[model samples]
Target: MPSLRVLNHAFRAWRRNRAWAKHEPETPFLADLLSGAPTCLHVGASDGRHSYVMTQVAPKAVIYAFEPSAFAFEVLKLGIAWHRMGKQVTAIHAAVADKPGELMLVTPKKSSGRMGRAYAYVAETKPNGPARPDLEDTGMETQMTPVVTLDAFCADHAIDRVDFIRMDIEGAEQRALEGAALILDRDHPHVLLEIHPPMLQARFGGSGEAVVDLFLKRGYRMFALDGVRLEERTTLVADLPWKDYFFIHPSRAARLPDGVFKARMAA
Candidate 1:
């Protein structure tokens, strides 16, 4: 049984997630991408909320769920099993980074402001950018978690093509991308990332600009998608905080409807 504090924290996190779900609901471009995508990747997938949603939104899609938290991974597993979605979703308990090795991760309980966000920062961040003020002490001790690279994992699993990838792995986004060069170069899968400057600073020792560069360097056109209107971005600014950004691999841009990547016109 979980402790009272853990249970209470979970309840609060769920409440915040529900509110965000109501406000942000999934977008159409995502629907289009998932419609026929044979495979999808969901990193930092906590409790399978989005995974379950994806199974419905993209009935033909096979989703990969990666989470580093043991407590959360168990819940995520249970959720997938409860929904009878074993065939469509596969869960892994590893953190993806620029290299394959072990690293210490500092995890804060799901107690973030704005929308109950939890964060796991790499203990030793060779960040590409400067650090910002710590959001909070978090006070949680560091835990050893297995680290894997996207490129290596794909090779080992023999996954030739990937259609879409949604990542929100705290702040190790850059490192994860850094390790996925081969896959991106070959498939150019649509990459959706959640960017948090403070978290990036705290964890990766880098900035959002660095995160964006990881894709742009590999021939991807990136856009900020959290706004009511989607806009292409050369880089991310810490002052201009954004949640989700989409990167299209040039080849699939014409296939998607404009509205999925365009601004919503007032009715």
Candidate 2:
């Protein structure tokens, strides 16, 4: 029965994808968006790999890359300095959230002496449940980190206009957006974000569509990153129960690459 159940899921996912597929010059979908923008905020910057890529593509753009993990921030800084991107990319050692305060971050337990460092996520309060085995692997531990909202950060820094934002801070997209209401309304920047269906299901009693809805309500359209262009999705499909989404505000939609709608979406 278990084997049959496994087969059943594979078949369903296969059937669902009867037609379709889902990086970069490091990240292709973002090239156009960043080309015209002078300032970009890269939330969940990890070790600054993508931040570096962005700078390479848009050398003049100032990238404010944020990574909450101390372990990760060190690496992020090293990448920026090693590449001599110190002048273009600023590595911020903090988390972007809906509010400015301390929040608990869950990461793999180091005491286990495991060879791999677990992917860390902001541990949400209550009902959301703990991180999954694959994410927290070998168990999880908590470390407190300071978090700030995009709005507050922008205001405090006297940044009047923001053009692009790439945020993928685990499952905290919704909460982070809650705190970014000011930026979204004022800056109207283009965004690239990762939506974890499991994270929504486990933490928000919702699905990936809910995440889409959140952006839609904010006057953004969802698109899957397709090579050098943006492919708008009338129906949201999750390739691996998780994927990144490009949220183009109406103001920026006019700048999307041509040939984006060439192929029809599989019905």
Residue range 53-115, candidate 2, lDDT tens digits: 677667888889988887667666656655678888988888887778888787654435542
Best by lDDT: 1
In candidate 1, the residue pairs with backbone N, CA or C atoms under 3 Å apart (3 or more residues apart, or in different chains) clash, namely 127-205, 129-206
Pairs of residues clashing in candidate 2: 24-27
How would you encode candidate 1's per-residue C-alpha lDDT over 132-243 as one tens digit per residue? 2344432354567788888888889888888788888766787788888888888888887887777677656777878777788877887765445566777774475447
Error of 2 at 227 (Å): 8.9
Worst 10 residues of 2 by lDDT: 17-26
Model 2 global lDDT (CA atoms, 0 to 1): 0.67
| Candidate 2 ranges with C-alpha deviation above 4 Å | 1-26, 109-118, 124-130, 133-136, 204-207, 225-230, 255-267
Candidate 1 deviant stretches above 4 angstroms: 1-29, 109-117, 125-134, 237-242, 257-259, 262-267
